[model samples]
Target chain A: MNRLDDDDDRPLSPEEMLRLIEEQQATTVRRLGGDPLLTHTPWGITWLAGFGALYLNYAYDLLSRSTALAVLFALMVLSMATTFFAQRTVSSQVRGEAADRGMMYGLSWMFGFACVVAICVRLSPLLPSEETGLLWSVTSMAIVSALYAAGGALWRVRTMFFLGAWLAALNVAGAIAGPTVHALLISVGAGGVFTAVGVVQWMRRRGGA
Target chain B: MTGPRELDPVIHAQARLRVVATLNTLGEANQITFPGLRELLGMTAGNLSVHLGKLEEAGYVEIVKTHRGRTPTTYVALTRQGRRAFEDYTATIRELLDLG
Candidate 1:
């Protein structure tokens, strides 16, 4: 690599300099913003497979309850781990206020879920076994949707906010419809939402939108 | 306040201006990899190194060399002095344009 002469001194007009600054800043943002598809697709698969198994176990008894629970637990854990590491990978690439914000946002998810667990454990003994399961699923979904909504609002992403709203509605309908139907609703409905959103984001990025 | 303020000579050049502008987007404590900044500015490594050396000399940017595993990596960050200089430069520009 050859170093060029350092004697070149040219002045830019104020308007031109401002324009250049704006253009370069925009380029930096575009280059550093991580792909949404990577974050969403794995989650889509996890929800689809996890809830599908739960539906099978509850509705058709195709798998034992313990087996279904284990599968769901494993998939959820895997999805969470994938999301955590994916975020860390992106954060590792750049350092700024955005990185700190991302860390806080990630921690917020853990905090939200912890509160859900605490609430559920406290409420579990009052409900029957079957209702306890229903309570756990509904509360968990509620927390997820609420967090998504909060995240969307924080990030100013309209699609994420709408997705959270849609999922919240689905949670209500599932709760009213009972556990078996709730499992099926989340399996197809929420899962489909995740998959569809991932595809749309992928397409948008490919199109340079 | 009486005479027109001049832009910082170090940041007045086109390439150096763009470099400072790009680095300005980063958080105060945040650092970007050498290749990362180079890619952002679309500048060759040698050219960027030259400009960065000037900035470092002026206390505008800090460059650190550290090992990431077995690979040596170069990270660059804007310093408080540099950020203040850039801010002043922009304010001066805006003042010149009568927008400030």
Candidate 2:
């Protein structure tokens, strides 16, 4: 028997006792809804750096391929080192769902990259080399923007949703503006938005702390 | 009123109720660390440990201990059984309230 009913001699009516329990449950549920784990801190600078590297690789076509590859390798090393340290410092319990979501997010990006590569290769046979890069850029941007937008909808995060919308708009604007302008728009416009979001989140976290 | 009769006594205890309630809020995809759970429930380490032990013994929750660099961390997740029990408990509680 529940402890609530253990008191046979209790003067309170059943309705009154039930009301109290309901009220308590409501309070508990409300408190639970406020759990901090729901909001994730966006590592804006990391993403900005990543996008900047890509833009640089495309914008400076005269740069040696080896140099571009070396820059990418350096960026990869930096990202890995930062992640290794972050895991040790961050103190959250990752559940299976969060882990699964992360895995899916990574897979989506990889798949998007692969699709862009395959499309570029196919288009190269039909189009001039000069047009191929621009086509690839626009398609890749659209894919990433759509993926982010889809993720935002699934996660119900307003910031993520807005970022996705912004990226899509940038991609459209880039298409009309030409290759150099498109690269700059992605590297600065979209990248700036992500960085700003991260900065604001960092400031809020510091303030709260 | 006979509250929904399926309430698991192991889960109905006041402190454990809060713990389970909090975990349930995360929607099965996330676990809670020992410190996170303790702070959320406002319980001391010893008290929380005892309640967690009971839940673990009942096979309702799975506890994992891992090392993050030099520090040892403990994570707790509700097992499928535990989730079902929690659901049943809430349904019963709702039934009891509605009986009025």
Top candidate when judged by TM-score against the true structure: 1
| Model 2 residue A122 lDDT score | 84
Tens digits of per-residue lDDT for model 2, A91-145: 3445467556755765787798899889888887798654665687688778878
CA deviation > 4 Å runs, candidate 2: A1-95, A124-130, B1-18, B29-48, B54-75, B79-100
Tens-place lDDT per residue, model 1, B35-78, is 88887787888889999998999999999998878998888988
Per-residue error for A21 in candidate 2, Å, reads 17
**lDDT of each prediction vs. the true structure?**
0.80, 0.64
Error (Å) of candidate 2 at residue A176 is 2.4
Complex DockQ, candidate 2: 0.22
TM-score, candidate number 2: 0.56
Q: For model 1, what is the alpha-carbon lDDT of residue A113?
A: 85
State the lDDT of candidate 1 residue by residue for A173-209, as single tens digits.
9999988888888888998779888888778666753
Task: Specify the highest-lDDT model's number.
Answer: 1
Please identify model 1 stretches exceeding 4 Å from their true place.
A1-27, A30-33, A206-209, B1-21, B27-30, B35-47, B54-75, B78-100
Task: Give the clashing residue pairs of candidate 1, or none.
Answer: none
